[model samples]
Target: MSTGVSTSTDKIIVDKSRGHRNKAVSKAVRQTRERLQSGHASSSAFDRDVLQMYVTAVLQGAAIMPLFVIIVAALGTYFAEDASLLFWALLTLTCHTANILLARHARTKEITAEAARRWRNLLLAGQFLIGCCWAVFALQDCAACEPSSFTLYKGATLLIALSVTTMSNFMLTPAVLVGFAPAVVALAARSGLSRDILELSLAGVFTVTVVFFNYISDRLFQFSLKILSFQSEKDDLIAELEVAKSMSDEARRRAEEANLAKSRFLASMSHELRTPLNAILGFSEVMSAEVMGPLANPTYKEYAGDIHRSGQHLLDLINEILDLSRIEAGKYELSEEAVSLLDITEDCIGMVQLRARAKNITIHDQVERQLPAIWADEKSMRQVVLNLLSNAVKFTPQGGEINVKVGWTAGGGQYISIRDNGPGIPEDEIPVVLSAFGQGSIAIKSAEQGTGLGLPIVQAILAKHDGQFILKSRLREGTEVIAILPAKRVLQSIPAVEQARPVAKKRRSFA
Candidate 1:
């Protein structure tokens, strides 16, 4: 029983020992893998960790290369006097070559992502080369040094340290960060833990932070500028669209107004042509009646005369229509000549006297004895006066007065005026009456027959003469129409050839 128990205990102990050994082997394997990875990540030329490692290496190499060289020389002196100078010369050459390599790689390039990365790679390679050379020198020096004595740099080590400082400081931060990291790490490790290493580490951290911040700021500013430019272009397009819309609206309004004017003109012209035809037809039917006897019946003879007169009146209306149409179509021009204003006014009144007498209205003429001759178309001016007198006689009530006045106005113009006691026009409706085919509001409600083209003709005629028509009217009191024209003397090349003649001496006269 004792042997069995002892065998079981031995078996258990052996199994436990094997398990412990396995774990120990596993841990050792893991540690070795971790060390290899760390070494490569930190010291490899292409690795990001090289920046820290390289900077450490540089400071440490600088602080201790002087001591290492001294120790190597001392050992050489003790073993072989001639060999010390040979080794020293070889060390100097190696240090200078590494520095030159570093300097050659650290040049400015175009700023871009790919270029920045390439810069980092180049700097790292340069730093790694420099560090490796210094490491080899340090190892060799330490190998020859005494255990108890401290070593300092010789002339060769001093040169290496100075060259590295120049390269690291002169290179831009992005390049320097990648190149100087390995040097810094090595320097920290080998420099006996000095304050100089701490200062250098802080400097490294600050430089890298500033460089990254500046790069980010530049990118943000570029993005903002692009956004502002796009917005400005958008605003300009919107303004152009608004202007186009406004122009389109204005053109549409003008087209509509032109169409409306065309429709109104057509309607008025149709009415004018039909009105004269009705009178012609009515008068012709009456004249054709022979029931009252043709040769000797006075009543029948008067009826025939009335028919003839009506036919002539219709012909006159037709002729006026043609004249108005020609003027409106921009074809009529004034045949200017010296005209007698007094004679024109008297003829107009004589023509409309029968119509005024039928309404029992009184006609009065007020003329300065002899008026100055005016520059006007004699026939057109006579028609203007006749139209005014006829209109006054038509509207005036029985026993009401129609007054005709003609003279040279005090304000340097010739004027012919017709005044009547009649229902007058409203202020707001006056302007509309002056328009073609437009008439007064009162005319719309009355039994009066008008073609609505009279005033338009009057206005057209005055415009051709370069003259003005003035209307003064008050509701229920009276109305006055004035035709003002530039005096004819202004156009005369001869100074009133008959100025002293008795015919021209008087200021006003009758026809």
Candidate 2:
């Protein structure tokens, strides 16, 4: 029974050992494959980036190598036989010079797949040759040296070689191995030749250290490759973003050019178009009034009146188009002056009153009394008031009421609001109504269709004055349009005490 238990325990231990061995083998194989792949992979942009980095490291190391060589030569002269000092110094200098030339050459060349492989191989070869130089120094006998002095010299040389190679060439794992393998083998062989337990143990420890360094180098290479890949992707994304921004800028410039061209075309044709239009209106009016002679048929006078009205409407549309074009082209220069808002509002109301009366629409004017005058363009302000009133009159049904108010805003700005209780615009269609040549469904189906320029022109003019225009409407309820002039445009009044006093005696003297 005891034997059976022991057998079972042994089997279990064997199974665990086998599993561990398999795992170690798998790990080793994976690491080997990775190293091989990294060494022989075809060059891409990323590979070039890695090569560039490697060259930079080499250049930096080249600078330090000469200093190291000088220090080692000094030490050898001071502590031991100086016989081989010149030979070692010359070899070190030559190796460093060669490495510098190679690194610079690699930097100058545009790396391709085949070229990259060749460069890497050359770099590895250079490193190996340099390692052999150090190895030759380390392997040389120092019979004149004391035991402690010899130990110190050997240890220093080996440490320097390992550290330099490990740090400078770690980004390329294969390069690290090739560069330091000779030095490590030479040191191990030298240590073993002593046949002392401590020396052999030291050699074993160094071998382990070399393996550790190689492992670290491999990991570092992978990490550096990942970082470079991420940087490349980031560069690509930045390039694409720059391209998109340039295209958007170009499109914007083209659109502006097209708009300018349309404005120029319209401006050029204005005089020619208005000349015929004025003639048509003038002749139609004279015939309708029968000022020269009586018409042969009474119907002829009515036809002339219709022709005159149509011509007038066409003239108004043309004028609206021209004004809108000028505004869009940034050519509408404001002629600034002190103007009374109340006066302008009254004039606009008078102009639209006849039309409002035809529809039986009631216009309620609620203007503030003794309102301050504003610094603004007189003609533009008049047009703004007129456009708002006309829109109200046009949209309001018979017997519907419109409220027009001119008052001070909360911000001390002056505002004119015109509201109509008629078939208001749909909320979704408000933007359409405000755009140039845009009309809502309700406005389209109405008895009268405007040129759709009134609101847009008003909005543009307000914007030019650094003011704001707001339109609010709801379907089947009402619509309100407000034009606000900023407080900065409000002209301050003189003090009452500053007024000139009347002369009381002037009237008596005249009598």
All models: lDDT?
0.59, 0.80
Model 1, range 149-183, lDDT digits (tens) per residue? 32233223423453444343322333333433444
| Model 1 misplacement above 4 A | 1-320, 488-511
The Cα error of candidate 1 at residue 270, in Å, is 11
Q: What lDDT would candidate 1 get against the real structure?
A: 0.59
TM-score of each: 0.45, 0.77
- Every candidate's CA RMSD: 30.9, 21.1
Candidate 2: C-alpha lDDT: 0.80
Residue 177 alpha-carbon offset, candidate 1, angstroms: 20
**Taking the tens digit of each residue's C-alpha lDDT, what string does model 2 give over 1-511?**
1212344533443343334544554565555445444543323545666778889898877777788888888888777756687688789789879988989988888888668767877888888888788777767666687765566676666666677777888865577667667867877887778775544654576567767778888888888877776665565456555655555665565567567556655765677678898999999999999999999999999999999999999888989999999887788999999999999999999999999999899999998988899999999999999999988888899999999999999999999999999899998999998999999998899847669999999999999999999999999998999999999999878877877899777545554
Candidate 2 matches the true fold with a TM-score of: 0.77
Displacement of the residue 123 alpha carbon in candidate 1, Å: 26
